[model samples]
Target: MKSELDDQLCRKYPTLYRDRHGDPKSTAMCWGFDCGNGWFPVIDVLSELLSKHNAEVYASQVKKQFGSLHFYYSGRDKYTDGLVSSAQSLSSMLCEICGSQALIQTKYTGWFTTRCKEHTKDYSDKEYVELDVSKVAYLGFGKAWSALVLILIDSCDWRTEHNGMPATHLSITKEAGKLIVSHSGGDDFTYTIRSLHARFQ
Candidate 1:
């Protein structure tokens, strides 16, 4: 779901708004919901181009992938192509998270994100102990989550047994976006943990 500020931006660029099924207002869902408000300018330009050509434009998809916006449109013409090019150029200067003016693109912990100074600082500095699962931890947490946990462990250079045995003295920490496995050590790896279950499922 998009924030209220983003919903206002969506209303301003209705042409860029579409449900996951590519239907018009069929749902309150948004494909670019994860995208920051920076895309607003790009969509605004696209909307203007659509109006100029009197073309009916529909976004088949709109989302950020691989650190860039993947704005799939059904209509293609000189104007639309130009709009895409302009958007590409503009995206480099806009934060991928909040749409603020960005000064840098970072991959500090393996996940690439373009962000302004504020978001960049937040993302770069954000760190915490995500989990401390026991060997008997429930799998109801699901395979996807297990995969992520394993990845994070690998990133932090933490040793793990295939049996999912919880380390008696395992320590998980985050520093400079990379998960660190020890209370003190140089060993570390870069992996992003997208979601953490609040309770054992």
Candidate 2:
């Protein structure tokens, strides 16, 4: 997926993706969603369903493997498991390039992909799938586009823990000409805006 959609999803559904930028050792999500743009709807629908579910479920990794959708996750009930299974099955009949109808058979060229007629010829044995950007909007990430950024800023952070914290009543006195930043929560690990970006990014 384009980095825009990827970032949008990670930021929109913070709880579902808190680990997306975390240490790879702690989460396969750090690799991010590894699939084509066509599967956006499938992922979108599934994410909506999973998010509404009462459990604190999360996906560890989402990718395409062997001409099929592979959504590996942890913390699921019987219904959520069924939802994942159904999404995987649905991918079998849809083009991985355009999300249109296609013959997703059990096999294809030695290196295979499930593609519609328009995209089948574009497949190659030497290359991994890299899809073009499509027009589909990942607006399903949230309902309100206007408030999404503000909502995300407060609700999501690269580190779910206190990114920059001190205490409720914090102190920030410039030692010399340099500036300082602190919160009431605790002393901030990063003292400058640029440093915070560097540390988080």
**Top model by TM-score, which number?**
2
How much is 149 displaced in model 1, in angstroms?
A: 44
List, in order, the clash count of every candidate structure: 2, 9
- lDDT, each prediction: 0.47, 0.56
Model 1 Cα lDDT, one tens digit per residue, 1-201 = 256755664566565454443445654234445566666555555555554554466666556655665667666764465455445444545576666555345466767655666666656544422223443144334333443344344423433343333343335444564433433332111211111111111
Candidate 2 residue-wise lDDT, 1-201, digit = tens: 778878877766777777788888888889988887777777776776677764477778888887778888787765566566556655655678887655453333575466666676655434333322121122222212212222222222332355443323322333453323244332222222222211211
The C-alpha RMSD in Å for every predicted model, in order, reads: 18.0, 17.5
| Steric clash count of candidate 2 | 9
Which candidate comes out best when scored by lDDT?
2
Clashing pairs in model 2? Answer: 165-186, 166-184, 166-185, 166-186, 166-187, 167-184, 167-185, 167-186, 168-184
State TM-scores per candidate: 0.47, 0.57
